[model samples]
Target: MTPTSSDTTASPDVSGVVPPTVTAFDGNGDVDPDATAAHAQFVVDGGANAVFPLGTNGEFALLTAGERRRVVEAVTDAVDVPVIAGVGAPSTRETVANAEHAASVGVDGVVVVTPYYYPLDEEGAVAHYRSVAAAVDVPVYVYHIPSKTGNELSLETLGRIAALDGVAGLKDSSKDVPWLAQAIDANPDMDFLVGSDSLLFAGLELGCTGLVSAVANVFPELVVDLYDAYAAGDEDEAQRLQSTVFDVRSAMKRGPYMAGVKTALSLRETDFDVGGLRAPLRTMDDAQRAALETDLRELGVL
Candidate 1:
């Protein structure tokens, strides 16, 4: 009996985990394990309730399959935090394999994105996630960011996956706020994280549980502060901080998501250059770096 998109009793017991944006590095375009650990600790110390390794912001699409596995393991080993592995690929087999690996490595959960670079329609996306979730034992977070992947996890698709046993959450990165509201109300059981930091304050104000933001990698404390404040009815402080956070969020628009985040970290510290975009993405230019700095300095973040 194929399950309809109405069931939600079997979802995992994950209540308040802020799947943090991850960092990448290497001496020769490889997974630098130590830096990985350091970055994991950075988020943990900054107060991320959990970590989401190999996310799009982690440049998962750019890394090799083996490197992805290493990252999932590195982050899980680095912190006492629960790691939700982002195990999405262009094919079901690969996604399932990654999910199985995440479960094998003992990650707390797996966040699965829709398979990009393919004409995956609603039915396909639904099937892809269901198969991936069934292959692993941990909870699964359905990643919905259409801008980069060329695929959007529609409310119908999201509901279907949420109905499944292992699909426990949805990472809504779209700019559409109404559907996000719909998704939250639609799946009262599954955790729906605000995948966009710019909307984090407003999203939480409306009832979002947490955020899976890329910018969180740069200013985790600020992000966590908002989460804590909003949850505790500190609307006065949340609005004030949200306005100031724009400087950092604005600079991120200057380049690719991961590159922009890495650049921000580089500007703030002496020991954090993870090197260029994996490949195809040429290294950021001097002018671009200057622009990023300008934004950071304005925010007083640098």
Candidate 2:
């Protein structure tokens, strides 16, 4: 399904288990748009409410500008769900350009991570988001993953960003419950997506409307069930699923950073082959793959 042109004034509903999908690659380390789109479709078919491409899982930092744009285009064309492309770069100019490209391709919205490498002051962070939000007509969701970007956004900066014209919400992976709760309380109207699998239930309880789960890329049904149970007011079921997710998360972390999802996908019954992570980011070795498979089997996820 082709994505329709984005509506600038209305914020797209990004609430639910949205997978920050991995970018599929061919053997030569080239981006494979078809395989990437198929992975996106796979998650959506597994009951994911939406899909996010070019995120951390997508290895956004490694891809060239052209590769990033192609992934966005392919994923948007493959699924009828909201596609929120990750358009983050270290520089505001590059980020704005990425966002503009994403919007031009008909994404529902864009997720902008905090500028990395150089530490940014609160004012700089706010101004960066302001410029990105102003450049595109689509709603902009702030991506706050400090561990990766090396730039942390404070509550004051977030409040200012939330007030921007086309700013829609935030996806917080900081894992700071107090900070997340305070942010939610402060911005009653802005949507919040819990970006860590460990805090999905907690995030929902703290008033977050959505989840941007890396676990969802491999086990979309598990995350979706958790969300549905909570929405259905079945706290017990949600908690049980959350426990299950913890197990799954542990098993997926058996390999190198960001390797588990793709490895698990290859091990699934469907035997999906999205290829290995691009160089510098290694794939699971033989031993790691064996261990991961055994763990998944014990958990009955494989």
Give each model a TM-score.
0.90, 0.96
Q: Each candidate's lDDT (Cα)?
A: 0.75, 0.91
lDDT of 1 by residue, 188-302 (tens): 7767778776888878865677777677787778878777887788998887777767767878678654567777777768365555567765555788889989877878766
lDDT of 2 by residue, 1-302 (tens): 21122323877878898899999999889999999999999999999999999999999999999999999999999999999999999999999999999999899999999999999999899899989988998889999999888998889888888878888888999999999999999988788899999999999999998999998999899999999999999999999999999999989998699899999999885535699999899999999999999999999887
Best candidate, TM-score: 2
Superposing all C-alpha atoms, what RMSD in Å does each candidate have to the true structure?
3.4, 3.1
- For all candidates, the clash counts are 0, 0
Flag clash pairs in model 2. Answer: none
